[model samples]
Target: MITHIFNSSIVSGPEMLVIPALKKLGEAVSIIFLTETRLPTESARPIEYAMKFGYDVYSVPVNGRWDKTAFLELRNVLDKISPRIIHAHDVKASLYLQQAKRVRPGFKGAIVSTHHGASYRKGKIRLYEEIYVRFVLPSFDKVLCVCELDRKSVIHRGVPEGKVSIHLNGTDRPRVLPEDRNASAATIRKSWKEKMPELPDTDAAVFLGAVARLSPEKRHDRMLKVVASFKKREESGHCKKTVLLCFGEGPEEQKLRQLARTLQLEDRVFFMGYSNTISDEMAGFDALLCLSDGEGIPINLLEAGWAATPVISTRVGGIPDLINSNEAGFLVEKKASDESIAEQMWNMLQNTKQLTSVGQAYQKRVMEFFSHDAWLKKLNEVYATLPGKI
Candidate 1:
């Protein structure tokens, strides 16, 4: 059986992508949560969900960064489980697994680590990553990358080319069907209006959405600038009033709100914070926007595509891997000026028919390539090719 190691305190794309796979795997797998730096309460949802799948879930505390206590705890769990393979996700978990091997030399399980995304850091943190990549990572039997770009990045970072493999992210199509979009959208919009009285109740109101954390990398301020530019065009009576609804909460909330106020977009920009109904609410949006300075095949864009919602996103990281070749959506430079974003929005406003056609094509691509079944098949192939015989 495979023992997966990861930090489950946050509900990010990696966690969402992993849970469905583990659920389907049943008793074939188990998971260990490394909560050295986070509260056990934060991991309650993921743990409860995994338990429902009949997978054994274990939680261990690692009190500090580079803590020896974390290593001993992991080694103890490995000894009890005696797993044939230890699959770790993210940097901290991967490092801890390596330490477990040192602490318990008798454990002969093969080590596998998934490099979900490149580290975005500076100063001491960046130096630490450079050292880890050059020395610690090459020891793993296999290093899985979420996209081709990441695989190449790993090879460049001193991991042997033979040790790295690409395992692109995937998602299950939501239970909500395309035929039921009208009713679902109507219901979602009604609920949203009740919660946000400032939102227009009419169907004509253009609803653009960005579903990501309010962080610097997400560039929500740029999204606000785009809205501010769009509002300027509206003031000239050239377009209808539009509202940009931002979902997800993070450190930049107050700053974004203040920027919106400064731009006189208090009425045009609405912050919806976090919502569990993101997939169900996709039908309510005319388009989705992702202005992040970087990305790793964002699950939001994938969900939007599967929901047949047209997306406008910056070409960065694995984003170009999804949108550049497809005729289904628009791509802009990461440093694209707000004026440029406004121009694209203006053009999209004049030709709404493209939205439906593009959205359909996007959904087709997702169904063909990024479906859960395809991802599982690919994952099985990766597992079969591992160095150690299972």
Candidate 2:
């Protein structure tokens, strides 16, 4: 049996992507999870879902940033399970696994690590990552990356190229039939009107939404600026009234709200905060805007496309690989001026036929490459190549 381990402190796209794939690969596989965050009063929804697929989920407390206690806890778990292969996600988990291996010399499982994104973007590497990559990464039998860009980042940080492999993120097409296009559109419009009661209920109103954390790298402020510019154009009788809906929340929430007010967009921009209903929300939007300064094959893009929504995103990281300019969706160059992003939005708003064509194409592409079955098969292939217990 193949055993997979993961750290789930921050429940985000990476957790969503890997856990589902691991479950679908087969029932014989066992999954063990470790999270430093205190366990919720109730089991996590993701953990519950994995259990239904025959996974054995476990949670134990570990110091969030400290290595000694975390490594000791991990070592105890490894000794108990004695999994045939050890798979760790992100730098922290990988470091703990490596340390555990050192203390328990008889452990025979091949170690595998996956890099989800570039740590350089967050801040200088923490002391743990600095030491781990230089000393522990080379010891892993194989390193997995979610995209080519992330793989390159890992190599640049000292991992050998021969030790790494790239695996693009994937998603399962929704089992539901295609939503009634007209009904879905009308429901979205009605919801927007309720949110912005001052706005008229007409096709003249454009709804733009983005799903991302409120962070410097995500550039939520840049999106607010685009909305503000559009609002200014409307007041000047140069464009239709537009409303911006931003989902997800973080430390930058208060700052972004302040910026919206400063730009006089308080009445036109809606901050819905963090949500688990992203897929349903995407289905209701006219367009999806992604303004991240960097990324690693965001699951949001695939989610939006799967919902048949056209996306306008910055060309960074692995996004260019997923979207074709003017084909699946529009690709705005990074550091694009607010006016440029606004103009792209304006053009798409003015041409409904073009937007519809692109949205349909985007949906087709998602069904082809991001389906759950396709990802499960790929994962099985990866597991087959790993050294297994006889």
Candidate 3:
């Protein structure tokens, strides 16, 4: 069995790949929940979902980041399942998989990990990642990267180029959108005004949505500036009002709100905080925005493409794969300044027919090329070529 290791808390992009993998791979896969707490409470979403698939789900708790003893405990669990592959989704699990080999010398399973993407995490998290990139990652027989940029990043750090493989992220298309597009959008707009009383009338407003954690890497402030620029155009009677609804919460919430206030976009920008209905609500907006400084084949963009929601995103990471070549949607050209990208967002709203055509092309690309079956086939191929043989 291929035992997948997920050490995640919230259900985000990783689930976009993992949940379907569990369902598709079925009995061929099991799961090892490596948790920092006693009950693996941090990973409740994945654990509960994996159990529904009837796979063997093992929850092993490491006392803390410094716990080498955790690997000894893992050996007890490994002895029972004896999975030939231990595939980790994060740096911490990948590091411990390396340590598990040191503690249990007889173990011969192949070690594999998925490098999601690079991000600007600081403090102890950053330190651990530095070690993980430089040391622990080299020990893995295979390192699956979500994008070419990530493959280049790891190989440049010392991992053999042969060991790294690029697997662009994919998604299952959301079941067909509600039949009445106008009614669905009206419903979404009505629901938003009811929940967020502070929001201005959105019926005629060009609604733009951003779905991401309010983290520094997401660069929400850039989105706020776009709205501020739109407000300036509106004041000069040059454009319609644009409202930005930011979903997901993080440590940077207050900071972003302060910047919004500073830019005088209080009425134009609305913080939706955290919402589970991001996929459903996103269909109402004119377009979705992804302003991250770094990314992989981000699941949100994939969902946007499938939902037929045109996206205006920074040209970073694997986004060009989705937008360019096909001319599927808007792209803020490389190394463009904050002012330039703000203009990109501005230009996206200038034409309505272009939005529908671009969104349809993006939808076509996602449906034809980025399917669950295609992703799993690549994953299975990666598993087949691992250096360790059972």
Candidate 4:
């Protein structure tokens, strides 16, 4: 059996992939959560989900850094489960597992890790990646990358190429059925407008949506700037009314809201926090926006393709691999100005006829390259090759 280890306290892209994987793996796998340092709400939902699926679940304190007690607790759990394979979801989990391996030498399971993102780095974060990849990653039997860029990044960081492999992240079909998307969208738009009456009401409104944590890497401030520019265009009567509705919760939430207010986009921009049914709401949008400075194939973007909603994203990380720039969807530069994004949004609104073909192209690519079944089969094959697997 294989045991999956990941952080269960924060709701992020990696957590989204990890939860569904645990559910699908079912009885063949178990999960160990690296307990959050802060209050766990959305992140803890995965643990509840594992329980619903009747899968064994455990937790060990992990404070995002080295914790000797967490290592001991993890070792004890490994001793009890005695899994044939140990799959760590991110760097921290891998670090903890490496320490546990040293402490519990008797448990000889193959160690594996998934590099989830190509995040911006500086100071301690850069130091951590350098140390981890140079020292810790080599010890793993396999280091799975979510994209080709991440695989190269791992190798460039001093890991042996033989130990590294790419297992492109897979996306699930839209959780919301086609019949339900429209109704879900209408209901959300109505309810949100009712809650905040300052937002303009117009039958010609173009809805642009994004679901991402309000973090620096997410570039939410950049999204707000785009919204500001779009609103400027709207004022000039260049197009119909435009609004940017964001869904997700994170540390940068207040700062982003403040930026929105400063940009005088409070009326046109809305931060709806986390939504369990964001997929259902996609049908209401004209296009999904991903303005992150870097990413590892965002789940929201994939969900957009499945929902047949076109995308407008910055060309970063694995994004270009999916979007073909004006064919499948729009691809802005990594440091694209708000005016550029706003101009694209306006053009997309004006050229609604092209959306259908672009969405189809993206959906086709998703089916061909990013299917969940194929990803699971690859993972199982890797697990079977491990030393203790029967």
TM-score of 4: 0.91
Comparing 3 and 4 on TM-score, the stronger one = 3
Q: Tens digits of per-residue lDDT for model 4 on 1-390? A: 678898656656776666676566634778898887565675577677666657688978666577888888899999889888889987788889999988855766889998876545567767877777788899999998877788889898888998888887776775444456556567766766776666555344778887987778888888788778777777887677778888888899889888888998876788887887775557667788888878878888877877777898888888876775577888888765678777876677677678766766777777677767667777877666676442
Instruction: Between candidates 1 and 2, name the one with more favorable TM-score.
Output: 1
Candidate 3 per-residue lDDT over residues 235-318, each given as its tens digit = 898656889989898889999999998998888888887776776666768799988877778788877776788899888887
Q: Can you give the TM-score per candidate against the true fold?
A: 0.93, 0.88, 0.91, 0.91
The list of candidate 2 runs beyond 4 A from truth reads 37-54, 125-133, 175-179, 188-204, 388-390
Per-residue lDDT tens digits for candidate 2, residues 1-390, read: 556666664457777777767766654566666665655532265566567765677654565566576677777777777777778877767777888788756776778887676533544455555666677788888887777777787789898988888777788645223556556766766775676566546365677788887878898888888888777778888656887788877789999999988999877788876677666657667788888888877888888877788888888887876785578888888867888887877777778788888888888887887777766776666667775532
What local lDDT does model 4 show for residue 281? 58
List the global CA lDDT of all models. 0.80, 0.74, 0.78, 0.77
Compare the candidates by lDDT and give the number of the best one. Answer: 1
User: Of the candidates shown, which would achieve the greatest TM-score relative to the real structure?
Assistant: 1
Worst 10 residues of 4 by lDDT: 174-183
Q: Write the per-residue lDDT of candidate 1 for residues 165-186, one digit (tens) a residue.
A: 8777788767446677667667
* Segments in model 1 whose C-alpha atoms lie over 4 Å from true places: 37-40, 43-45, 119-128, 175-179, 387-390
Model 2 lowest lDDT segment of ten: 173-182
Query: Which residue pairs show backbone clashes in model 4?
Result: none
Model 1, position 331: C-alpha lDDT score:
86
Model 2 sits at a Cα RMSD from the real structure of 3.0
